[model samples]
Target chain A: MGPDGSRPEPPDNPPSSEDTQRNAGARGRPGAGHILPVNRADIPFLAALGVVASVYIVLIAGIVLAKVFYVQLPLVGEVFTNPGYRYAVVLSLVSCSITTILSVWIAVPTAYLMTRVEFPGKRIVDAMLDIPIVLPPLVIGLGLLMLFQTPPGAFVQQYVTFTYAIPGVILAQFMVACAFAVRTMMAAFAEINPRQEQVAVTLGCTRAQAFWMVVLPEARRGMIPAATIAWARAMGEFGPVLVFAGTTRMRTEVMPTTIFLELQVGNLGMAAAVAAVMLALSLIVLILMRLAGHGRMF
Target chain B: MIHFDNITIRLDGFALENINLHIPTGAYAVLMGRTGCGKTTILEAACGLRPIESGRIHLMGRDVTDMPPGRRNVGLVPQDGALFTTMTVEQQLGFALRVRHRPKGEIAARARELAEWLGIGHLLHRRPHGLSGGERQRVAIGRALAAHPDILCLDEPLSALDEETHGGMLDLLRHVHEDTGVTVLHITHNRREARALAQSLIIMRGGRFLEGETARGQLAREEDDA
Candidate 1:
């Protein structure tokens, strides 16, 4: 027995020669004999498959990088100086920023409830949140357009311009970003031990205090990535913005819509330049997300 | 003082029915039972964390059944410590006082005092995640008592510790009970632990409360040790 009263475990040792070569006659290793396709013989096969998958990924990445350089290098000076493109950049930044904030506000409580509360129709509510994620963005925009024409939607639209407005861009982005936000927050809350909050309450904290102090602080590891993802999704959102919020230059035109606008004008280089900008932004967000997740790895 | 008067808690299929139990002011009592015997339910109901169907809880002479958990002023340490992993030991020990907006100086002083008393003064700045199980439990206990709660209800505080740490923690708990005169209702499945520290014991069987001879003997043994 160890000093701690734990039963002694056998020392982990290398497998004996006989143990390794039991089916040795079939396998073709240093001392093995025969071949078993499902056994050690599949090692090379798995490696080959892994190599092929990496090849495909690297090939796609290489094409993307090449296109980015090909289009962005020539147009960089022009695109950055152009006021309309700059306006698109500003519009994209503003709308996506608002969408991220709203998504977080809505996601925290919704995700918390989904994980902690057991209510009737809970599964239905959970599945409904995933609709935007599962469905196409263009379909989402179409639904929004249709809904705004309805009496209730018309009332909201009359008070607040939605269909084909800057607000519509934000609303559309929020619509899609919200699903990713909720998914991230849900996973965060689900993984956290509920006992920590329970203990906080016992320590004289009200439920809200416990949640804000204990649960929220703990969920930061998930929240940062969620926010970054929401921002990235909002920045890259195309179909919804293109359909719901028409690509009006200097107004609702965002970075994504600029890509479509340039494409329609037969300026493929400009289109790729816009895509390159998006890729840069996404890369920055992804890197920040990775760094944030790594910082929290203690 | 803590009183559970005919407490009944009914979940989907299981029910803890007609439980009547009391621990006097400043008494160190242990509630022992087999697993799933609703021992934790009584503890929860007493703290106002879990709702009771038919009973009122009177703590320190006030009928606090309708009071919210924060207002009840009962300290609870769940099994496994359940320490706030995000906070340092010092912050954890002072969490309750800080939440109540106690004076900064007073909070620091009290946290330090409790840390010293718990023999975790040196570990005050360290987070619970980095602490050993024993240290975590001590920090949890410190946090619970930081508000100077009248009744400290500990749920298997020593259950997760090794033998050496368990003995030390038991002695520490006994010291707290003796020195500070805080009421403690510790729950456990171990009879030896019940006999070691409890001034009185309540043995629960299928949600029915029974007084324990082991507890009575422990009270005598503690008296003799003192």
Candidate 2:
């Protein structure tokens, strides 16, 4: 026996050649004789398939890029001279910021409850939150229109309006953006260990205090990416905002609606300018998300 | 005294049944068990993290079975240190005091004293992610004690430490228990550590505590049988 109290072993050596042949040959005998497909000879075929997939992806990207350049780029110059399109881009930014802020303010608590609490109807609440994500934007807009166009809607509108105004645009954007934010925040919260908050509770932190002090800090890394995604979703919201809030210049007009209006008027330059701005915003947000993850890797 | 009377917890596919123990004030008790044998579950029940189907927990002569974890007034050092990432070591140590709204100067003094006591004086400014595993546990311990809890519940606090680090950690913990005279309930599977630190030991298996005394003697008997 070794000094560590383990049993001694024979000298280490490879198994005999006959043993190897027996195992290999036995695999092809009777019930164990299964045909094996070796991929060593299919290297050329697999490489060709990979090449084909890449070509398809690249071709689609190229077409999108061409449309962007031909229709969107030249419009920036025209927008600089035209006050209408310039106002539209500014309005879009303002709407997106409002949407993002409201969504985060509400979704932070919603996400905390979803992650940390156990309630009877939690699953139903979670399912309800996801409705906006899958529902068509036009359908949502139509629903909103019907809801607010009635007597109750008119009664509420006397105090707070929701039809074809900045508030309407903000409301529409908030609905869609909050749904997206909740999903992102749910993912972020799931990545965090619940034990962190439990530790906080043991350290004399109240539920709110634990959330703010322990849970929020550890989740910040992932939550930042979530916020970026929410921002992109808010900025890219088109159909609901267009249908519900109408394309009004300097008031309710946003980048997407401006692009649409420009497209209808055959003003590709202005449309391209707005699309370029939207693309740049999305690109910056995406890069920020990627960089945030990259920073965590090392 | 920290008392658990006939405590039972039923959680999906697992249960802790009929646990009855009384750890007197200022005595260091250890819960010895294999991994996933309800060592942590007992601690969780005592601290109110788990709802006991039927039980009673008396801490400092008060029934705390229905109390929420935040109101338990007993400090817990979880398996992972669970230190706040956003706070520096000093801030984390003073978190309980901050929550209690203690004076800034008092909090500062307490944080420093605890840090020095835990041998983490030099790590006051470091974040938890940057500290070594042993260092983080020390910080966690310091943070737990800063509140001046009536009792301390540790769940395998030194299990993650390396061999060399474990000795120093045990020594530090021994000093802390002696100096403060706080009742300590530490849980671990390592008999050597249980012998070193616990004056009273409870052996557990499959969510039930085995009826026995003489921890070292029991371990020796098991060894002989094997």
Candidate 3:
């Protein structure tokens, strides 16, 4: 509606709905395809999902930010200065980084196999890769613990010593984080037209050469976000870390476990301060995702 | 030179069956067919991109039926150019040589020479999206020719061009054929393109060849149906 309160005319050369269909945000839309005046009444029913999602996002973000702001800086400092906190920070950075790298290494081959091959049990394998996402993290912890009771698992425990140790946190984080990475990479690989690689093969390159030169470079956009999200997911994982690694102070105590331990001892301010730190890191990741996600160049 | 003897390709429910063809070395042969008549399928099969159900494919007197696309020494310029968006035209042209680990000076010289021959020398630094339809097609042809393949396969490379550019592309193809004497198999449904570019013609219908003296009329009917 116009300011004069007269019935507003339709926009001149109102753009087709096609260009804006895929993109959720308004700003990233192409220039010529936008500038059409939108009618409030004309919003589609499907937009209700977007509206609901946005509201949920805003409410959660708003509350988290408010709580983060309400924490006293000295209290945050106190929590931050604890020897246990310093160890947690260092352990987390090391374990999460290792988990993220290992997950990506596993994801590349797994995603490629899912995309390119047509084996007898390919669908079954694909579905099984997604099991971690559907299962509770606690179940994963229990499963890992049970597996370590078997001969090969006992061997792994004895030799590599992953159970109830620093390496256990890495293994737990890797198990969960790798699943997300595989899913992310599969979606990324699916979006790429295999024709480019086929063309590269026609142009005197072997299949492996074609994948390295053409497919990998083209997939960088997708790979960045996949790695980032998996990193963030690994960093924030709590249940599995707590169950498998036992939350030992200065040992397997990651940031999430630190928050848990602080709360268990009834240090509300320290718990909130740790929670706020996690929240801030997550918010930074989300912002980075929005800036470079969905194939937008960083 | 390419020889296909009783080749069968099954894609989904549709089957391209019992195809027999022999293209002599250095001949510019055009294969004409309606949409869904399995033109691209035959091309892909020849390139070893599609696995054939039966029979053998021989290129340059060597059996390539069980070989991969890279070792076949046959290059393709697909419909819509299929230009690599990640690379400039120069990079696209030199990609084959680069894959072979050729020295930079050698690759650059070959790329520049091929670009000039294909009339896209000026577009060397430009990305695929920055070029026009004809220019991209020209670069696509140049890229295919970069490795000096024994045979070149073009899938409707000029189908999207305007009438003026259509003639120009035909002339360019003719010039390339004359200059390089590379065996060329061109796919098109347009009779004008067949008339202009085809030194030898094969018409395909449903999966089989429309052979003998009546092949031209059958090709015309297929074009009309298209």
Q: What TM-score does candidate 2 get on C-alpha atoms?
A: 0.84
Residue-wise lDDT of candidate 1 within B1-226, one digit each (tens)? 9887887798888998877888989898988778888888788888887888887889999999998888888898988777776788889988998998999999999999998888788787887544566677778888899888999988888776666667777777888888879999999987668878877788765555667675465545555876
- Segments in model 3 whose C-alpha atoms lie over 4 Å from true places: A1-54, A284-298, B160-164, B222-226
Clashing pairs in 3: none
Model 1 TM-score, 2 decimals:
0.85
Which regions in candidate 2 have their CA more than 4 angstroms from the true location? A1-68, A71-74, A284-298, B211-217
Please give the clash total of every predicted structure, in order. 6, 2, 0
Ranking by lDDT: 1, 3, 2
By DockQ, the better pick of 2 and 3 is 3
* C-alpha RMSD of candidate 3: 7.0
TM-score of each: 0.85, 0.84, 0.88
Task: Tell me which residue pairs clash in candidate 1.
Answer: A24-A33, A25-A33, A25-A34, A26-A34, A26-A35, A27-A34
Index of the highest-DockQ prediction = 3
Native A-B contact fraction in model 3? 0.41
DockQ of 1: 0.23
**lDDT score of residue B174 within candidate 2:** 94
